[model samples]
Target: MHRPALRTLLGARALARNPARRAMPTASHYHRTSNEASTAMRQPSTNTPRPPSRTGIAARIAHQLLAPCVLALSLGTSMSSHGAGPAAAPERPPAGTDVDETRTVAQRTRAPADCLSVVLEGVTVLLDRSELSRQAHAKPTQWKTEAERMALIEGRRAAALLQAAAPAQGSSPACHPVTQTLDGDDQFVVLAHLERGAAAVLPAGATQPVPSVAIRYLGQRCGPLCGRGSIMVSIPGQPQPFMVTHWWAS
Candidate 1:
């Protein structure tokens, strides 16, 4: 072979034997390698966290729905621990005959069997034995002559007329009349007079002789002509038909 040809062949063999200079890469190959590297970087990683599954979402919804019930139970338990429990029922009265007996006993202890009540100038005036006795002795009376007796009656009538005409002054405490009866034959009567305040009594009746008195008014307490007023009497056993003296004023 020629010397130049032999040298060219030896250089080619040397280049092939050296791996670092074996071949030069093309532009398309370099572009393809760059694209693959970029794709790998952009892909999502298996190690990264993911969004919640359907089961997890359902669990959260269930917790929200039950939260109110759990809170209410806790509050109820706390209140019970503090002694705020359900209230007790009120006591009931006895039924039938037992109830009647209890009421009778109560009445007997509180007031006299023959007691009566009176109302005057919108005020409830309670009259008992002591009150009646006081009024009877308030003014000395000696109606020895028929003329004096007649005068007394006329004066009382005039006072009643005056009281009836007078305007009500003001209000007073409430006092309701009782309806329970004493012994069947026992009775009650209320009487009013012009010169006297008022009186409550069980007058002489067919069965009973002596009067069972409750209250009596002292005669004319304040006056230029003396306090003038009408009288009202309530009859026991009946509801209405009260006996009233004619209106009068001094």
Candidate 2:
């Protein structure tokens, strides 16, 4: 073989014999790989952003969820209160059973019985006793001579009896014939004139108390006597009609 060709062949054989140099990694290659990995690590992650604090994250979520719940609860409470309030109660109650139910002062003063208006002889009277007396006092009674005398006797008897029995309502009867008049629904006047002699004669003294006059209606007792405007009466029934005197006209 030629010397140059032989030399080339020998070098190729030597290069093939030392394969480690070709297989081994270079410093530059390693450095490049490291730089690429570092760049990937530095990039922003796909994961969500971190909150300023754990509590901050929780608080934000809670606020969003809680606001609607609180608002809903408040609205529900307001509706409940409105539905239960007094404006919900009824008006114009019907007559109840006759079992004498107790009532408050306001109920008694504001609402009275829805009584029937009835006529007695020539006069109209309220079915409720107090109303009848109230109307009678407003108008003067024009009685015949005999009727007048009878009225005086009746009035005297009532005064004497009340005075003798239980007194506290008045010192004297303060009785007189009817003068002024107001007819209650033009119904019956339950009350009559004052006793003639009784008005002039004061009771024996302050110690001698005048007894209250008792009037009967539907089997119920009413009044010390109806005058000045008011009556003490008993309502016998359930959801009870409040006991009261008609003091309005007076």
Query: Compared to the true structure, candidate 1 yields what TM-score?
Result: 0.22
Model 1 lDDT at residue 212: 24
Candidate 2: where are CA atoms >4 Å away? 1-23, 46-48, 52-250
Kindly list the per-residue Cα lDDT of model 2 for residues 66-178, writing each as its tens digit: 45543332221221122211121121111111112222111111111332222222222222223323322432255567434434333333333222322123323222222
Go through the candidates in order and give the C-alpha RMSD of each one to the true structure: 29.8, 26.8
Candidate 1: residue 79 Cα off by (Å): 2.8
lDDT of 1 by residue, 1-250 (tens): 9999999999889887896675678899899999999999999999998999998987787656545533332221211121111221122221111111101000111222222343432322233333333323432255776444433433343233322332322322121243333211111112321112232232323222112212211123142322333223333333432333322232
Worst 10-residue lDDT window for candidate 2 reads 193-202
**Model 2: per-residue Cα lDDT at residue 25:** 85
For each candidate, what is the lDDT?
0.33, 0.31
Model 1, runs deviating above 4 Å: 1-29, 38-42, 80-250
RMSD of 2: 26.8
